[model samples]
Target: MQSDNPEDQKSTEGMVDYNRNSAAQQQIIDSQAMQIRGLVEKVSNIGTEFRIVDYGCGPGISTINVMRPAIEACRSAHPGEKIAACHADQPGNDWNTLFGLVSGPSGYLNGTENVRTEAAIGSFYKQMAAENSVSLGTCFAASHWFSRALHLYAPNTVWFADLEGEARAEMAAFARQDWLTFLRCRALELHPGGYLLVSTLGSVPDAQEKNGFAASGRGIYRALQVVAREMADEGLINGEILDNFVFSLWFMSEDEARDPLKQDPELSKAFEIDTLKVEPAPLHQADLFADSIGDPVEYARLYTGYVRAFADSTLRKQLFEPSTNSAEDADRLADEFFHRLDGLYRKFLDKYAFEIWHLTVVLRRR
Candidate 1:
């Protein structure tokens, strides 16, 4: 069920060119393609039709890429079974671009017979399809998002890892609840023998790091904080707004991701863990920075675009838009903010890096 609170209704839909700018996310998906295919190959007892749902499938080629291997494996494993590629995301998602890609040259539908596409428009934290219907479910780079926009005050930082004291504890508790809700919803949608593959941003324990933890996107969030503070200092936004601003997402550690399944009797009885692991994710744009001989100008443009793609909508609604009355004022401030962020990236190219990690897990319904 959707939240009634307006703040909670804030959408995390990516910018229009999400596919082009989300190369790092694409890399995470690509790294696990073999594993996805392997799991599908092992799937048995599928009915006359095979249904594979991509939950939180943002608009892009990433979803297409993820579905291809599984589609092929399904075909090889269960010949003559019709295939259904179901894509699920928030209602505000760019469905046009998604469908465009689905019918485009690179889509799984290309030259493939006995296959059809579907769209399930709603939160993945709720049941997306009928019970015992989904054969294989996959969610990539999106499960970290909270079902609602949290109103918690995170005065020190814009990222969860830097949140301190009560803020941190509250965020962790909320994350745990959201994770279990997601698992329960998936349990309802999947068949008894269905397979679920999820890969999202994650964290790891590090004694040398602050809070004794290190997480993906830390540098990016720090850069965001610095740039937002600069804007606030210039009177573009108020101090209170800056202090309260925090991304409504969490990057869970490996143990945090596994705890519920290990501790909850219901989850333990509902599903069996096939694989759970965390690995460092490569930043494709960073590699391009190296190839460009550390060209700050080009690097900054690329990195800023990458960040803006996923974050622009949220920042606009939660920060910039709320700070001003006139739409034009909000637009101007947003443009200026990105401009300054780009300049900061250029000025401190070496200091800011998207050092990200990914948690990949495969679970089978019991």
Candidate 2:
């Protein structure tokens, strides 16, 4: 499957073809922020000193934010107690950003030891000091992005490229690997009876739901394929549709989480998903998406609003424009693309209404 791996914000080449401000991301953060607090309350290591690993704690904002409440609650329930919180992210993750998240304690939290923060890349997966020592573990919306062994290429490479099929395949595989890795690691990291709290953006199955969850992947890909063909016909972009480009995402499940990850022999029996529970994480801030937004036109408007909210309008346009030489031009182009995208979304909304699922899975390590 084709993959466009953007490692964090800046690459070695110093290209910035991405947007930093993300409202959907912020919405996700806000939604999960509270349940994470509740997960902290469920943990009680009465006599033992506490240690935790926020598995796949991307960039550390979620981990540190969750940790803050946990630390305070721990103190309140067991007054004058010294608790230690460990924020874990892959070594390849952005540490500087994680550092910034934890540096500010803001008097609401005090008396908790930082417990020697460590970055765990793949090698860190080998072993850790927390051998069955962790009291609580949470992978908030980040487990499904892990690398896996079941890397299979779909049959139709040409069709895949023409339709950005590779991207879909990659995201699907990513979804699988993330669940497997999270459960497998949960088995190894948590002590018996400890809980693993996981939350993620999940795909709903029905055509209407799917069209709703990812309306743009297909429409946008169609447009790009046409553009690629046109450019190639005119002696530009080498007319290569098979180049690296794809669309994919793993979505919500009511039952799959009950038995999601494929059972691999390499995974220890002890490190299995002993019990799984899934429920929809409802959206509270309707104002973020409009209270009564259902019309085809309104859906398109909301969809485009979402894209523009997440992306810098200017950078997206640069992909097609010859004069897109500077960052300003790129932003302008992105804006235009999103402006036109409202029309594209209208096409999808006319056919199907989407159901975006926020999934929370509770895994008990075997």
Candidate 3:
């Protein structure tokens, strides 16, 4: 059942048609296929049933990609074991779309025998499955989101990495706690010797950047800030809304991702970190920009659509809805906001290119 509370409702709304615009996520998953297969092959015990759970599986397009390797490996390692592939995400995610894709010809279940699929609706920060039930757990291109929208306001910036002073510290603390919660939840769901593979947006050190750290999607956030401020100045929206608006997400640095396990004894005992590394993720739009050298209009449209897919819901709820009185007015403002954002990308094609970095981690439940 859906929550009646507004905050709960807002927290549940996930990316809009995430599968259609998730090429970057697909790239990240494709790159990790070898690692995923290797990890799955290392599982020691063969049980009667093999369960693979995908946490934060938005729309199920990339979920299938992330799970296919594990499915194949598990089948090869322990043939004829009943396999269950489960996708978990927020309640308000595009479930219809996810289910449609899962049943389609291209889905992981299409050609596989003795395999079943299931959905668990809720936060990944909480357990979504029975204890010791999951053989493998995977989260890709998600988990950067906070458990809930933080009440703290960031007046100067629209993204976590750009926040400074107290605001940044507060956000970091919340992120650390959320990460531990996620690990603990997975620890409970995954059986002993089960594997958890995670790949999400991450931060890396850069002396030249602000806050002495560089994160993925910074350019996109920068563009959003610029367009939002422009709208505020033009009286399209209130300056106060812009001041209070910040994406409820955080990209953890390598140190941030590791600190909880290093500091918390319980977490340390729950899972042993097999691999944790940060590497640059491919920006699919950049390739398109290079290919469409003379067609900035097409490139801008594609890039803006990708941004809108993941960001439109947040902007609508947090920025436009509160800035306006009625739903109609909010919709109008959201349209105008994206229109301006698209125009900004068209004019400065090179400025908003995404430079994403991903932190890939493999953990074994102990």
Q: Per lDDT, what order, best first?
A: 1, 3, 2
Model 3 earns a TM-score of 0.94
Model 3 residue 66 distance off true place after TM-score fit, in angstroms: 2.0
Ranking by TM-score: 1, 3, 2
TM-score of every prediction relative to native: 0.95, 0.61, 0.94
Residue 300 lDDT, candidate 2, scale 0-100: 72
Tell me how far the alpha carbon of residue 8 in candidate 3 is from the true structure, in angstroms, after superposition: 2.8
Q: Candidate 1 or 3, higher lDDT?
A: 1
In model 2, the worst 10-residue window by lDDT is: 9-18
Residue-level lDDT of model 3, residues 1-366, one tens digit each, is 222354563543767667767777888888889888888778756466888898988887788787788889888887778888899988887888888888798888787788889999888887899999988889987888878766567777798988988888988888889899999899888888889998988889999887999888888899999988888899877788678778888888889899988899888999899988887765543343456546889878877888888888888777787788788998999889889888988898868878778898889988
The predicted structure with the larger TM-score, 1 or 2, is: 1
Q: What is the lDDT of residue 138 in candidate 1?
A: 95
Index of the highest-lDDT prediction? 1
Off by over 4 Å in 2: 1-22, 44-48, 78-81, 105-129, 148-178, 207-244, 247-249, 260-281, 284-288, 291-355
Model 1, span 235-260: residue lDDT tens? 89766877877898998888999999
